[model samples]
Target: MYRYTEFDKSFVKSRAAQFRDQLERWQDGRLSEDAFRPLRLQNGWYVQRHAPMLRVAVPYGELSSAQLRVLARIARDYDDPDPDVYRVASAAQGKLGTERLPTHCAHFTTRTNVQFNWIPLEKSADVMDLLATVDMHGIQTSGNCIRNISCDERAGVAPDEVADPRPFAEIMRQWTTLHPEFAFLPRKFKIAITGASEDRAATAWHDVGLQLVRNETGELGFRVSAGGGMGRTPVIATLMREFLPWQHIMNYIEAIVRVYNRYGRRDNKYKARIKILVKAEGQRYIDDVDEEFRQIVEHDGAPHLITPAELERVRASFVPPALHASHASHASVDEAEANANGHPLFARWLQRNVAQHKDPALRIVTLSFKRLLQSPGDATADQLDIVADLADRFSAGEARVTHTQNVVLPWVRASELLALWQAAREAGFASANVQLLTDMIACPGGDFCALANARSLPVAQAITERYQDLDELDDIGEIDLHISGCINSCGHHHSGHIGVLGVDKDGREWYQITLGGSDGSATSGAPQPGKVIGPSFSAAEVPDAIEAILTTYRDAREHDERFIDTVRRVGLTPFKTSANAVRVNEEVSA
Candidate 1:
C-alpha cells in the first residue's frame, strides 16, 4: 500500500477541521440542510434511513493489518455503543455470537472499499479524525467527484498477470485526488485498471476502464474504454483507444473527462453520467475525445507526460515481496496431508477457496464474508480483528477487499494452506463457496440506505439460508448473483450472471431479474451486460424464482458446464418458463 506524504497528511487534516466546523454550523442551525448536504457528502457522510452512512476509501482495495485495526478501533470508539436492529437480524440467523459487536461495522464494498451504515450524524467528524490518524479518509467517496481508483486484487501475484497494476493505480490516485477541474463534473466518475489476463475488476463497466496491453512491437500500453456504466440506461463503454502509450495515461484520461465535462447534460441529474453523453453523441464523442487528446499531447508541448524519475518514485513503492525458493516441505503440510485423507470438509474448502499464485510455492486464498444466514458483505468487528491476525500469521500482514464483496489473502504459502483454512474456520470466515450461488453480492438495502426500495440484505440472507446445502451449491457452480436495492447499482447487479435489481411497486418491494450478464474476461474481451428476464417479482417470490431458474439450467446444461455457458447455449426462454413457476422453494418450505 502507498503511504501518504506530508502534503497528503496536511490535506486530510485541513479537510477534517473544515468539515468539523461545518458540522457545528449545521447543528447550530447557522447552515441550512440544503446548504450543508454537499459539504456532508464531500466528507462521505450520507443521511440514511436509521443513521448516517460513511464510505471510507480503501485505496486499490489494499489494507495493511494495522490500518484495518485502525478501522476496527474507529468502530469501537466513535460508532454507537450498540445497534439493536442488527443484533436481532443476526440472532435470527444464528450469527449473534458471544463476541461483543461494534456499534457499526465496516461493510466491504463493490469498489473494494468499506462503508459504515449506522454512524451518528453528530459523530461524523470524530470518525474523520480517527481515519486521518491512519492516513485513511473518505474523500471522493460521495458527491460528483472522481471516486476511488480500483485495480485487480490479485494484480501482482496472479498466474496470468501482465504487470503489477498497483503502481499505475497509485499514480492515478495521487493525480486525481484533488484535481480542481474534475471535482465538480456533471456527475460522479469512476476508474478501474486491470493488469491480468482475467478481468476480475470489471474494467469495461467503469467510466474509464484501462486494460494493460502489449502491442505487436512489444511496447507496453493500454486498451482504454470510456463511458461504460450501469443505471436505468445501462451502456457498455466504447473503446476509446486501442493502444495508448503508457506514459500518456494521465493526459488521455484528462482529455476524455474534459470532453465529458463540456458536453455532458446537467439539466437532469438522472441523465448526467458520462454514459449518457457517450451514447447520445456516439462517434462524435469519440472523435472529440481523440482530437482533444491529440492536441493536448502533440499540438501542445508534452505537458502531461510524467518524467521517468517521478514514475520510478511511484513504482518503487510497490516492490514485490521477497519470496523464498519453492521445493520445500514442512510438517504443517504433512499434518494437513494426513488430515486431508479423513477430513472431507477441509479438502472441499481448499478446492474452492484457493487459487494458483504466480509463484508455484504460494497460493492466493479468498476469505469469504458471505457466510450462511448473514448479509453477503457484512463483517463483524471481531471478524476484522481475526482477519488481521490471520494475515499477520499466514500472509505478509496484508489483505485485500474484492469487488465481489469478499476478502483476499493474496500471498499464502501452499505449505501453510491447511493451517490457515483451519484458522479461518474457527473464526467463521471460511465458507468454501467462492464463485458459488451462496456467495452472492449484495448492498445494504432498505434496512440502512435511504435510496433503497427493498431490503437487499434479507433477500441475500434468505437465498444463502435456502441454499445452505453444500452439495446443491457445488452442483450449481460458478454462478454470480448480484443484488442492488435500487438503480444506484452499488452491488453491481448489471455485471452478474444472474442479476437482481430491487424496485418499489405500490410502496412494496419487488425485484427485477436479469439473466446472461458477464463482466467479460480479458481472455474473452468486453463483457455482456445482463438482459432483463421478464417482469418483476415480489420479494417473497424471489427465492423460488431463483430455484426454478437453477433447476432449468441443471436440466439443460451439458456435463460440468457453468450457468453462464448454459444460459448462452439456450437463451432466456427456458429460464423464463421455469422461473415463472415461483413455487418450488415455497412448496418445500410449506
Candidate 2:
C-alpha cells in the first residue's frame, strides 16, 4: 500500500482544520445550513435519512491492513456500540474480537465512489488522523467538484491487461485534489481508467473512460471515450481519441476537463453532466475543443501541474508484489481439485466467483455477496470486519472491492480455499452465487433513498425468492437483473440482461422492463426498455412477471444462448406478450 508523504499529511491536516472551523461557525449560528453546505460536502459530509452522514473516501477501493485496522478502531470508538444493529454481528465480532463494541459506523464502497459513511459528527478529528496516517484525504470525495479518480480494482493483477492503471489514477488523484483551476465545475465530474481485458471499471458509464491499449505501431496508447454517463438520460461515451500516446494521457485529460469547465451547462444541475454537453454539441466539436486546449496547454504548460518525473514518482508507489516460483506448485493445484467437491454447494462458486491469476497455483478469490433472500448490496459492519480479518489472514493483507459491488481477495492461495470459505460462511458472505440470476444488482429505493419513485429492494427480494433453486439457476445460465428506482439509473438498470426501472404512473408505482443491456467487455451497448408493465402489484406479482419473462426466454432461446444474446436475436415482443397475456381462458359453453 502507498504511504502518505509529509506533503499529503499536511494537506489533510489543513483541510480537517478548515472543516473544524466551518463546523464551529455553523454551531455558533454564524453560518446557516445553506452557507455551510458546501464546506461540509467538501469534507465528505451529507444529510441522510436519520442524521448527518459522513463519507470518508478510500481512494480507488484499495486499503492496507493498517488502514483496515484504523477503520475497525474508528468503528469501535465513534459509532453506535450495539453489535446487533446489523445482521452480521458474529462476523463483526470475529473480526474485531468480542472486546470491541460497534460504533454507529457503517462502511460501503461504491462502483466509482470510494466512500465510508456513518452517523454523528463528534469523531471527525480521529477519522482525519487515521486517514492522514495513510496517503489518503477526503478532500473532494463529494461536493459539486471533481470527485475521486477511479480505476479498475484488479489493475496490476489481471492477466490480460495492458499495464497497471493505478499509477495514472494516482497521478490524476493528486492533480485533481483541491485543484484551483477545475475545482468549481458545473456538476461533479468523474473519471475512470481500465487496463483490463474486461471493462471492470464501468468505464462506459463515466465522464471519461480511458481504455489502455497498444496502437498499430505497437506503441503504448489509450482509446479515449468521453461524455458517457448515467442519470435521467444514459449515453454510452463516444470515442473522442481513437489512439492517444501514453505520454499525453494527463495532458489530454486536462484539456477535456478544461473544455468542460468552460462550456458545460451551468443553468440547470440536471443538465450539467458532461454527457449532456456531448449530446447537445456533437463529439466532433468536443474533439476540436479538446485539441485546441491540448495545443494551448502543451505550448504554455498553462497549469504546470504534473510533470513526467512527478508521475513516475507516483507510479513507483504501485509496483507489483514479488511471488515465489516455488509457491506455484502442483501440490496447490491438487489441493484445489480435492476441495472441488468437498461441498457441492460451492461447486458453482469455485467455478464462477474465483478469478484466474498470473500465478498458476493461486487464484483471485471473490467473496460472493449475492445470496438468497438478502439485500443484494447490503453488508453489516460485522461482515465487513470479518472479511478484513480474513484478508489479513489468508490473502496478502489487502482486499479489492469490485465494481459489481463484491469484494475480492486478489492473492488467495488455492490451498487456503476451504478455510477461507468456512470463515466466509460464518460471516454470512458465502453465498456461492456470483454470476447467477440470484446475484441481482439493485438500488436502495423508497426505503432509504429520497429520490426514488418506487421501492426496489423489495422487488429484488421477490425475484430472488422466486428463483431459489440453485440447480434451476445454473441451468438458466448467466442473467443479470438490475433494478433502479427512477431514471437516475443508480443500480445500472440500463446495463442489465433484464433491466427493470421503477416509475410513477398516475401516482402509482409501475415498472419498465428492458432487455439486452450488459456492462462487460463482451457486450458494449445499452439495453432498450420494453413496454410499460401493469400497475404496481403486491409483492407477489413482481415474481410472476419475472418468471414469465424467464420462461419466454427459455422457450425462445437458441441452443446454449445467454439471455442478452437471446434478447438481441428475438427482441422483447415475446417476453412482453408472455408478461401481459392472460393465462386462463373463459369456457365457451354451448
- Which candidate number maximizes TM-score? 1
Once fitted onto the true fold, the runs of candidate 1 whose alpha carbons sit more than 4 angstroms away are 81-103, 323-339, 522-526, 583-590
* Residue-by-residue lDDT tens digits, candidate 1, 1-590: 57788988988988999999999999999999999999989888887765678899988999888878888876666656345665665455333332433344678999998988777888888888888887888899988889999989898889888778888888888888879988999999999998887888888888999988889998888899998998777778888999988889999999999999998889999999999998889999999988998899888875778777877888787765555335546654466567767779888988888888887777899999988656777776777888889988887888999988999998788788878988999998888898899888898877767788777877887788899888889998888899999998887788888899999987778899998877875322348778888888877889888988999999999999889888988999999878776755455677
Question: Which window of 10 residues has the lowest lDDT sum in candidate 1?
Answer: 93-102
- Count of clashing residue pairs in every prediction: 1, 6
TM-scores, all models, native as reference: 0.93, 0.88
Tens digits of per-residue lDDT for model 2 on 150-176? 777777778888877887777777777
- Model 1 gets an lDDT of 0.84
- Of candidate 2, the 10-residue stretch with the lowest lDDT total is 581-590
RMSD versus native structure for model 2: 5.8
The lDDT per prediction is 0.84, 0.70
